[model samples]
Target chain A: MTAPRLDRGQRPDGADFPDCKRTFMEFNVLPGARAPYGIRNGAGPRRAVAGMVASTYVSGAESEGAYTLHMLTGAKGSGLPLLSHSEAHVTLYVLDGALELVLDGQRYRMGRGDSALVPAGTAYGFVMTRARTVLMAYATATALDSLLAGAPYDGFIPAEDDATGPADLLKGDFPGTTVLGALPEGTDFAEALTTLPETSVPYVLEAGMGERLLVADQLFTFVAGNRQTGDQYLSVMTQGPQGDMIPPHKHLLHDELFFCLDGAMRLKAGDELIELAPGDFCFVPRGTPHAYQFLRPFTNMIGWLQPGIFEPFFHTLGDPTELTRYPQTPAPFRFDRVIAKLDELDIVPLGRPPEAGA
Target chain B: MTAPRLDRGQRPDGADFPDCKRTFMEFNVLPGARAPYGIRNGAGPRRAVAGMVASTYVSGAESEGAYTLHMLTGAKGSGLPLLSHSEAHVTLYVLDGALELVLDGQRYRMGRGDSALVPAGTAYGFVMTRARTVLMAYATATALDSLLAGAPYDGFIPAEDDATGPADLLKGDFPGTTVLGALPEGTDFAEALTTLPETSVPYVLEAGMGERLLVADQLFTFVAGNRQTGDQYLSVMTQGPQGDMIPPHKHLLHDELFFCLDGAMRLKAGDELIELAPGDFCFVPRGTPHAYQFLRPFTNMIGWLQPGIFEPFFHTLGDPTELTRYPQTPAPFRFDRVIAKLDELDIVPLGRPPEAGA
Candidate 1:
């Protein structure tokens, strides 16, 4: 007699593997496959929080209460009072224009691709230095949710040329959020921002500096790592060639988040496929089957994995190289070598081999 | 300060993983990656054994003394006496022409892609039914190596049109090979070879008749599985789309053997890359970094993994489906799901990602 059929997610004997928990949520798609897991194109629900258009693309609920992602836009001169989150690690990546940030009695100017991390309970605030300055912020758990709890606004920030002027700062009694009286003054902006040692103390990484490593054809630059975040999360900038990669696979213990920085890619979640462009974001919770195919050469993506256990996977698989970027024509790589370490690396092949990629 | 540079094959702190054992020996490559791990093209040293040209492509030294692979060619009507291996499981896959096997007093004919398994100590023998008939045979451990001990012959076999008749059977006092008198008589040829239950009994899977499974864009047909071989090995015929697949990976405990059945694929082993055509074979021993890219659409490859511990990986990752062939356009698959199961499965991704495939 023939052996019984084994279904997907089922054992050979017909018993189902434990069903994966769906803890993360996704935002509504904004044309094509664009969603919070991809470029938002200034889309998503917005709130007027402290005089800025706070567009929350990923809420705490979407990240299993680990973090929330928001795109904050404001006109030049827009500023906020010094404030702190009693229990949140806040990280910001400047996407366009410039901003001045004050932390620990020091003032620093941040521009495109620049990033800053504010530890829990650290008093910090910022002022837009260039018109239409945009920042992508991720605050742990519900801290940003509570701080951004304000009146809903149509997703529109009055341009510098508009006469409507900035919107009023909406107020709410948000837990864990403390708004200090006013912004600190008299701290001159440093000529340049220097990255501090990885620790709970606040620090910033310049536009193109971080812990850099090359593995195969991809260059991974870490903006914030386990040591800096106390094992809460890892933020990395990845640049690689454009093509279908990784194949169908899943993670069981940690959630993964992706924010496109440049170029485009097609992502496969379960049976669903979507295309992501610059500014697009995607969140793949633990247990979700996902794969990606870059659509253009040298696709740049920002990736975050929660709880930071998989950090060793990259270090274990990568070689220390002096090269700072992916090679134009990478030498052939051996997937079988990686297959040999599946148990230690948490990478399972989803029956889909790379040959299936178009 | 930046983190320390992590070297390839080294831990983040610079410690090396346990070096993998090199147990399999490879035959000399012939005009490309065309070694015994791939198509042989009638190359390699040969022995005239039991009236057949036995070309030992993969020796016991090559498989960690686990198994050996040989290509046997003989003229039509050439036969062997009933014999049995005392401690070896023998398997045969007909590649060209036809073979008639007699086991337990039952005779059967096997054509291209047809397969048979003879359990250890089981009595069996075979005769070439078609001229220039070729059969790929594998015997556990050194059993076949001992039985095929004969005078080295210039790798040539007399054709049906040749004036010289078949070479006289070379006599050898081989251990574990008990030639039991002559071929069993009065055993009529069975109308068809029917596969027996998965057990330690002689059985045959007629061409195109085996346990077929579709996972992603590949169709895996199992001729001899773990249950049938007492967990010694698994023999599968795989058909999939042509492209880079599986990525750079490694297996720490199991050795993999590949033989091209049709079409072609490029294999990356360490720093070397080679293309394989039909009849080419590749042996990727444990801990070797390797990946494959199919050069044409719908490449067919025969794969065997020793010890059979990885069988469950396929069952776990594959869905029971009615489709008997790979889909022309397979739906997107998720490699992330597999990545999540890295600890459960033995697959470890080399630093390379799918996007790196050329």
Candidate 2:
């Protein structure tokens, strides 16, 4: 709530932010939302291939898609085609340098703050080698009709296990960010736009997957990213103090904000144990009871809700990769009749802080 | 009214025209305003004395005085560094190429849609010759204060009347972008920041001049630019079906949204003309008495109310060497007494238009 001066203090209220007279697609009035009818920048593609530069500013989008941000410069080193998808659940934030997230064939070097998961159909490849600049926020996207529920999976792939051709749905290049046997198995999404590389296309923003969450660098994307317009997309996840402990728990529906930007954040929510820093901020609303930890070393910014793309609970951590405790049951959509459907949408989560022997 | 799709469509509710991730500075962000800020590549000192390639995204910001969006790309016959400033009021738009400006010593060129005004003390310089790209918006300035009512004039020079070294502001750059021009009898103002150019310095974003009426790209800035949150920035200037005139008009409290991004737009407002097209959208608000013109070739996207930093009525132009011809008259702030103080903040306009000679 601070925005009033429009330039009166003797100068500088916006000299001008550009519009040298026409760019291209211009419209988005902002009330709640509406943007998706674009062919986007491949502007003119026939195919020449390599010059690539993928994602660059991915911060949590709204919850359903949790903390999503993308950024990838030019395309040095090499190795990038291959793709597949069932729906997202990713998380890879590395701001300002370093890359090599291979997965499926194995590579992983990631830098900055490191956090990874590439589930769905598995088949990924990223090689920047050095010229790095990253941020990738993909929380939940489970809905492929509840993720291929009946199973059988086959969005297409038989034409003799295809090999290449057809793919540029706005730019999927080798089946998007690639990985699927690297390529050769009925391929065909137009061979992911014949290998991409005309340049420009990129920029595909979407949100959903429990809504999205990732505090420290402001990846609070979609505090409620939309079950259909519940509106929520606040990103600031700077990858701060991930001192990781997360012991306390409570969430009847959802309520939180833990706004810290580096070191300091104890937040027990509800009855309060607060303890914030870096310009502080807190709330954790809903049925109240909450949980969080990281004192000796911290990095804050939380904001919750929006299906919270917990991505099937972090893909159950690559299938029980040593469950770090905390489970008295309660974690599949954590429903209690959806807490009376989120207190009729007023949302309510004010519980958990009085525990240490309340 | 259409962005719900979050992704069964994979992604497409952002970046079609996407820009407002939280922008108050950085070229500009007013379609639903959202500017996030942070851009750097470097240059400025005669654009690095003159190798050029500068990049600044936006300037004059920080809690107050904010308005700056610069982008200078060079290569072919480079140019930039013949500056001038004093009192602000500088505007230049042309996004992906075409600029030759020069000023005071004369030259002009510009491209895209074109708009030039560098008054305050004049003496500019751009010259990209070709590999160009321009989108400069200034603010918190004083130079063209609606054509200097505070008076001062005469082509500016006295920064020391030409003593050699240091005054390149950008080649033949004396007190570049000047303002007021006092002290021929000596010179002062703290030696004008020891010879300016630490990116010029000055920060503050929203301080005064609010009350909305901003629409860039066919120009029309600050009307209700937020007058501290009274809210109302309208636009819509259409015309067709053998009808569209708007010659005389008044009412500047702020509010107008002519919309119609492509055809049909027989607008007028006060005397009535109406018609609008495309996704349609009208408001007018404030005291009303609008204006518009277009018997055929339509494309409306107005939305202007007033936000400040568009040189209070473009330095009330009268001659920056001449080119003028827009709406003019009603200078410094007057349009139905600022629309009667914006009808005590209720805001209205877009009263009639259901069809019939609309």
Candidate 3:
């Protein structure tokens, strides 16, 4: 697409905050946007690092949204308070040192190779264990796009400064704007979000009637999972093991696409473990038991059911009804009735592996 | 979209290799997909270094595409025949050695910081000056997608009896199968691309009009450089020292996106002199008077417009037009009504840059 929109010409009526209480900047990550932080070339670490840095690259204000790659770094010991979001789901990527994480009555030492998903209405905190760096992102889950447009958090910040004609964003004086497109000086509010405690109860997921989840790796990666129709999830996963008997399972309602990102991977339909790799793509017919895992770790770019994201379901536990039926940690066998009920919901079993020892 | 149709269904059409004089089992840098090739996880190195050995990660037709990363070491003095790509353009990413580079009738010692783009259709060679590792990448200027799909290449060579299956790919193997979902093993062709020699040359660009490109980093972090409507080569350039004047030079009809990747830079827009860093993004409006140089060995990412893709133009430039206007070698400013002729063929600027910048 063309560059994203960058202008916020006029403030919305009644939504405008008093200029005195505000310290804000209006910048978009789109092309041709102004650099607010006044980053001078050949000056300080900015020059040593070589190139410009974004003002703010983390997504806050929305709790359960999926975050994007945060290509940014800042002063050590930088942190924020425990900010809860209402729409998007939040997943924190610990890039360097460990982090102190606290969710509803839970505590965990989250270091590199560790990730946490803060669901909507969930309380979360992040404390830089030791000069920690992470990528925290999320997208709208319920309120949909309207919520993305109407972000609820609005703290008063200034657009222009007194001593400085316009806030020198390239030089990092941007306040309020957690989304700094120019001098993306991370917001102090982001620092406020680090007050979370540790861990609480463990949450596990189970397959329900028409439920399509296959297997998920804690929060690290989702190996094999199904999605409802109209749901979407973008993940870079490696394919599965060969003929790994993935019992017939289907998305009660959803379409699916698996795009190979790296290495070579195999996709198993009914009896097919079709091979795919970078740039090669695959699709799943809704209500199909499609299972895939590579012989090796082939990066699989998976795009599952759109309009309704399915990543959350992977984190959430299954309903009690299915629990009563399966009543097991890892279901011993693929239940036929349960799968049939799932198929009725438009979630159909794509196919099943050959009988064991065959 | 449901899983793509991937059943071979007894069609068995693959195996007709077009780029036929087949070669395999060597490390390579693929066209457009050039990441460092090291030994696969746990795979031993070909030879020991400091304390580690040098094992080849990319091992296929595409693996051999990666020349620099897959520095194979079998017996002493067992360097493989120089495998250079004639179909696609290539550039070297020198990680740990010096490469003898010859370009345009000149020889240059290209080490870590030095990179030379081997234009398509050019005679390029690499001579190892040190026992070091380098990263070399190639980008096809035009007909790249076709080259990726239709080109004769083997994605991987089974590691001498290694029996893991292929990764699931998006490329539908049966060209005639429209609704057919998954692809056959031939899809591994993408990952098969790797390493090329570093017989570097000056950078070049080419692309069809209206096509936008978001060149992403290894982790898929991408930046924008494509054009939009009412766009000009000058429009994207940053405001120089004295207001945003790039001088009275005529718009050459070709624009460029100049982004500082690392280090320090010196830029001239109109009569102003400006410095640059890695994060600082700049634009060189075509047909305008603008010039820049790395005052302190800065690495920059430049996207050229009008000419479209970079590799094709460099490869096609057997006899490049020179400009007598500029006060330097390979002068940056030129008056080529020829640019206008190229523009008429639909290779024109797209949209205007924002009054602001990304």
* Candidate achieving the largest TM-score: 1
Model 2, B259-310: lDDT tens digits are: 3433234444443333443323333434555555433221223332333222
lDDT for position A108 in model 2: 54
Among incorrect, acceptable, medium and high, the docking class of model 1 is: incorrect
What DockQ would you assign to candidate 3?
Answer: 0.02
Residue A177 displacement (Å), model 3: 14
Clashes of 3: 175
CA deviation > 4 Å runs, candidate 3: A1-84, A91-118, A121-144, A147-248, A251-259, A264-286, A293-353, B1-68, B71-358
lDDT, residue A313, candidate 2 = 31
* Docking quality category of candidate 3 according to DockQ thresholds: incorrect
lDDT of 3 by residue, B1-358 (tens): 1111122121212232222222211112223232212122113123332111233322223222312222221111111112233444443333223434444334454333233455445444434433222322323322222212322212111121221111111232322111122111111111101122222333321101111212110001111121211121111111111112121232344444344433334454433344443323333444434444443211233332333432222222112221101111121222232233444432332233212111
Query: What TM-score should be assigned to candidate 3?
Result: 0.29
Residue-level lDDT of model 1, residues B72-175, one tens digit each, is: 86665565667888888987887655667887678886665678889998888887754346778877888888777666765335321322222222234567
Looking at model 3 chain A, report the run of 10 residues with the lowest lDDT sum: A43-52
The local distance difference test score of each candidate is 0.63, 0.30, 0.28
Q: Candidate 1 regions off by >4 Å?
A: A1-358, B1-39, B159-171, B185-187, B191-196, B331-334, B353-358
